[model samples]
Target: MALRKLPTHFFPSLQHQLRPFSSLNLPTLEPSNDAELVSKMLLHHHNPFHAMESSLQLHGITLTPHLLHQTLLRLKHSTKIALALFNYSKSLPSPPLTSTSFHILIDLLAKVRQFDLAWQLIVEMDQLSLSPTPTTFFILIRRLISAGLTRQAIRAFDDIQGYTQTKTNSDDFCFLLDTLCKYGYVKVATEVFNKKRDGLLPDAKMFTVLIYGWCKIGRIDMGERFLNDMIGRGIEPNVVTYNVLLNGICRRASLHPEGRFERTIRNAEKVFDEMRERGIEPDVTSFSIVLHVYSRAHKPELSLDKLRLMKEKGICPSVATYTSVVKCLCSCGSIEDAEELLSEMVRNGVTPCAATYNCFFKEYRGRKDADSALKLYKKMKEEGLFVPSMHTYNILVGIFLKLNRFGIVKEIWDDMKESGVGPDLDSYTMLIHGLCEKQKWREACQFFVEMIEKGFLPQKITFETLYKGLIQSDMLRTWRRLKKKLDEESITFGSEFQNYHLKPYRR
Candidate 1:
């Protein structure tokens, strides 16, 4: 069975090798004439597996599954022989799979994400009375889940449950649970876990999975109670369990840090310290939560130290950690520190998200310096960094109005339109107010008319700012015109509008 290294032109030897097959007493599969034989030899043996095998040996070649299947089928061989050929080809040391093998071929194809072909092979396996292994079903289910085919995955899981009488292992349960969590099928996962309660222990990992699912969907109390139940049942919480619980606590703290039940910050610290005492090394996620607890308590300096501690423990600072630092610095109006940290973030290949830009913009707003804020906005756009959120635009417009920087205000209004940053009603109102404040009555009136044309009827403050601006310009006729417009629009103008803007002018 030595494979001779034939010459570059190997057909003569192959023709001689296949010639004996023609005289064999095996079912004769002749291709009509010598021309057909020559054609088959050139196609299958000379050109490889597409050619018929009968003439292949004459060209110093061998039969492959692809070649054998076609030759056997042409000779009207039994289906059993086809199956045998397929199985034999599976064991070959070259070219991999046989065309006729169903199950093995499907398994191989499934491993490579060729699920459509694998499904066809499964149908073939069913025809042959071959059962798919749990691994096969699991692999297919995982693929379905990743493809976001949840309903299909559920059907597949149901199929797996029906076909097998053996108890599902922890790994299988975890896979189902994770898939359920991904698709927000927590109730289904819960029912599955509960139905198999006697056979399954609610281990720490399982509890963590369930808790995280509940927490993700804003069921913090339920998640916390579940965590306590695990603790009460003497189930030791693992790192993931504690990390998720700490996250829950931080979320509560953020929502209501100064509320009546405001001890979440202390509770988070306690959990972190307890986790450390239990020999569970706090990872960067856990450390970031602890930093949040400090930040919530208005102790940014301590949060910074925790950042240093994270580095000391070989934990890399996550984007969340960097964001928290920038937020804290901006809250304290430490713009320089915030800017330096942003530079550091860029150096470390961390691009600031919109929230980071917002934090800086908010500080600039507090500084009441429209020029600095406008420059930062231009810089953000020029760098092709994060796009400003609606809140960013709102803050910018508000600051520009406060500083009476009407030119920059006009630029913002035009920029928003050109950049497809559609502003809400508040943005329009703010622009109108900015115009009125700068005594740009004609422009303000035009903007107001545009707002009405766009179906945004003027609010009470809009008329108020316009009326006040007109009075300040000592244009009695224009004030009457605005009042008439307000009356026609049925917008209730408050006394503060008239008193604040009209009193001095009336005097």
Candidate 2:
């Protein structure tokens, strides 16, 4: 919610400096929930402490029980503000807050490792005669897991029946699996599934999450085994299940692009084929994945065949689909063919992103054809195909810097800032590294200072390389000044780093 006046409801960290949103229509959000309404007033209009008193009076809308819950959930990500609002709400002369309300506040407290306070409130809910819902335990379990209290999360789940009146259902089982899998606790989630597998009959979703969890940790073989188990036990795998395995297979295959790649690719194809055999038609995501694998294999023909098959199947190829085929064509030196596909994609109304254009730029970059690369970049900007993202700028700057084109690098750097793409750590690193290579120690020092002030920690190698240049130029005063700044910022530069004066640049 970066939009103005309506509120930065999503990102509390980025809530400041509400930019003018002249292009936006405020009335369009007319039915925007009370959550956004109060959130806007609280965050944008008044101070956090006196917000409910002033802004709610000003807004003149009542905070109903449902609205309060929604607002709490909306601000759940911002624990401090949410806790303040909850505490404030408790003092209000409205209906007594429910067990569910206490659950959210407990969640906020638990996130900050204030588990003692959270449990006290949980006990207090019982005192208030509020019956605990399964969500009471779910909230505790989820937040406990997030806090890396894995055993505690499981304990909370086990204590669910003892606390909450509601019996755990399939939804609860799947929810726990989903939550655990989300945090890369696949093994633990599996253990819970096995222990609780007595009376409860599981579904495809239960198995899918386990597959997803296994896939997330790069265990493609384990994911494959789950798929086999599902099929053998008369549990049917859907498009989502197949898609997950295919993604895992493609990812593994991409990494092992040596002798193992072909075998891995064959496995992906088998899962893909199994989908069609089971009457599960591949969605755009499935097709795009297959296209990506073909791109990695550098099979331009196979990539085009897949693209052709997609159109034949009446499935629209996405920007990702075109980008994959472009990568394949570019890899095999079919620049003309890739360009033709890009045009085809545009004609089909799927706008090319930075990645789609980056493929062409990369081809020219590899050939050291700076003129052709810049030409394509210029054409894209002028034609309004897409704005070059920070990543695009980073790549363009690297290309210029590699060829020692400092003048062009400076121009691109200025343009990048002008485009409102603030230089991040990677951008600063690229510019500082490039400057060091050119013996522009002064510029490197300035940018390095800016980088540090912006809370970016430079790599030890980069720091040493830049400092070595300063020392060689007899700039000990400059070194002392920078060293003082580092001390104030509580950043350490050990004696070994300062002793870069003795050794030449390692490279």
Best by lDDT: 2
Q: What's model 1's lDDT at 401?
A: 76
Error of 1 at 314 (Å): 2.9
Find the number of clashing residue pairs for candidate 2. Answer: 0
Top candidate by TM-score: 2
Local distance difference test scores for all models: 0.59, 0.70
Report the C-alpha lDDT of model 1 over 1-507, residue by residue, as the tens digit: 111121121112111221211121122333434423433343233211222232324343345444553443331211222233344444445633332434333333332234555566555555545554455566566555554555676677667655544445676667676556544566666777677657877677677767766665567787888888888999988777777777766644453436622576677778879888878877766776666656556666876788888888888876677777788888877789889988998998877777778888887887776668778888887988876766677788788777777777777777765443445456677777777767788888877755543324445557666766677787778667655654543321222123323233342
TM-score of 1: 0.44
Task: Looking at model 2, report the run of 10 residues with the lowest lDDT sum.
Answer: 1-10
Query: Candidate 2 lDDT, tens digit per residue, 199-227?
Result: 68978888887887788678978988998
Instruction: Name model 2 segments beyond 4 Å from true.
Output: 1-210, 228-236, 254-265, 491-507
What TM-score against the true fold does each predicted structure earn?
0.44, 0.60
Instruction: List ranges where model 1 is wrong by over 4 Å.
Output: 1-223, 229-248, 251-265, 273-283, 432-507
- lDDT score, candidate 2: 0.70
